[model samples]
Target: MARPVPVNLALRDRRIDIFFAVVFSAFTVTSIISDLLPTVGVDFSQPSDNFFVQSNYWYAHDADPLFMNPPDWMRIITGLSAFVYMPFYIVLVYALLAARNWIQLPSVIYATMISSLTGIVVFGVEFFGEPEFRTQNAVKFLLFNLPYVLVPLVLLVRMRKPLPFTRRF
Candidate 1:
């Protein structure tokens, strides 16, 4: 059996890679901070509340028929993201910035799981839930959620192939 070839991060365009890493890192950090604020007693229900939560609430209001209020399930999911996934994203940010070869597998796994689950739940609520809870604007809803789906997908594709290895004599 032949050994699988590995992808070389060094061979890729450094500037572009670094740019993406920086952008994703910022996104992850902002998300973590936004989610963390609520845990520290920041009220997110009001539009005048924390900027991150306020922005997110408006986005959800514009997209989801549920409006400014999230359902219990959604709240639970948000809690999970806040308490668990946010920290994981911090690690991901570091790994991405460093171009660590070991991150490829875990990144793919995390991206797939998070994106797929989010998609399923979001779309399910939009389509199958009570009429009042269905999304008013599918396009806006999808657009609002696109980053979560697309970023991970792009990462998965870029990191699908493993990094090359040099055999020790």
Candidate 2:
């Protein structure tokens, strides 16, 4: 039989946890809001010219499109995020703010699933799609998307063990 390792109720580093929570909270909130707004017309592909959409489109519509001309699958996944993942992120933000230990396992699972899906999409587009669909700058693409991948991965590692079912802060 496997022995259960004890988890500390107190956060190992309060500052880091708070920082990640704030960043992700902001990102998820913005994503949800941007996606929810009505586009300029009936075109689901044509997003409104709001700050968030414009900023995202600027990079997406570049010479070697990163997000501007995403495949149908990407669009569908993003749409799902607006409804499903956005709410999940909201819950995660609350959990993080409360320093709820119960969030550890779910956080790890979320990280793994999201990161893996992102990897599959990015790599799949790069390899299977038309050459023009590939990102113009590999390094820039990775850098831009690194946080989404890294944050969850780090959180997964940090929360590998079970945490106490109590608030830390």
Candidate 3:
């Protein structure tokens, strides 16, 4: 009889998971507070159809995008920050599901795939296009991104498992 192959739990590298958690936490929170925070004063009262269109125009031209627009470099940094949120959330939720004594591996994998794809799209837009509608976009981005930070923190606090160790320490 052929020997059975051993399953690789090495795929579950706890060190990397913890590292991701830390890095993602830092990136997401910074994006939310430092970059997007200032956007609170952005003008969003333009005509409905012109909102996003105007924002992107300014983004493309490297001009002041709105009433309280920051410099282009700042916008780039903030936009890029939005990209990492979904993957962070995905990994966090997957971690929770996996650590739960009940959920199956297939379900965890499915959740990860979905969240990873979401992160890709979020990042892809920032990569290929500049958002024109400054205030609306910033608000929507924050709404989507904040949960990633909160869910993981809450889970890490409540879960019994030692945080998946990372290379940080």
Candidate 4:
């Protein structure tokens, strides 16, 4: 007798996973393209000259030579690179986590999610901060390429099990 067909749930899940992988890859490709392009060097002016900050070492010192009281959001965005690598570090930790079980899949997914969130927050901060400090290209790099890194990890994990039709081919 023929074996019973796999449940639709598994099929649906697989399809969604594949879709995510493709989307992630597309984002990575586009981000690379945008990064390669030359900056237009267009200048945009900001409204305020000074910034307001709480009592912190960096805050105590002049954050920007031009803007005495740059907005809090601007300060964070200007320094976003400090946090951008955290997601990548998480991915490596998850790689170790993967060795314990199939936990890598979730870890990879979470890494992507975290990276996306980081990108969004950075973008918002930059937008609200100084007009000259805008860096959408940096945000694009993180959002697009970060997810693609997980796709290969997932594919390798899934290849262990063969489908029923594979024997006939």
Q: Choose 3 or 4, whichever is better by TM-score.
A: 4
Specify the poorest-scoring 10-residue window by lDDT in model 2. Answer: 36-45
Candidate 4 lDDT, 102-156, residue by residue in tens: 4344544544544454445544444554565443455543444344445534434
Q: Over 4 Å off in model 4, which ranges?
A: 1-13, 38-121, 133-169
Which portions of model 1 miss their true places by more than 4 Å? 1-8, 11-16, 33-46, 49-53, 164-169
Output the number of the TM-score-best candidate: 2
lDDT measured at residue 4 in model 2 versus the true structure, 0 to 100: 72
The best candidate by lDDT is 1
Model 2: residues >4 Å from true position, as ranges? 1-13, 33-49, 63-66, 164-169
Task: Write one digit per residue (lDDT tens) for candidate 3, span 83-149.
Answer: 4443444555455334432323433443354344334543344334466523445554546454544
Candidate 4 global TM-score? 0.30
Give the Cα error of residue 63 in candidate 3, in Å.
23
Error of 4 at 3 (Å): 24
Per-candidate TM-scores read 0.72, 0.73, 0.29, 0.30
The residue-by-residue lDDT of candidate 1 on 18-123, one tens digit each, is 6556657666675575545544445555576567777656665688655345666666666666776667777766675566667768777877776776767767
Per candidate, the number of residue pairs that clash is 1, 1, 2, 4
Q: Which residue pairs in candidate 2 have backbone atoms (N, alpha carbon, C) closer than 3 angstroms, thus clashing?
A: 60-68
CA lDDT, every model vs. true structure: 0.64, 0.63, 0.42, 0.36
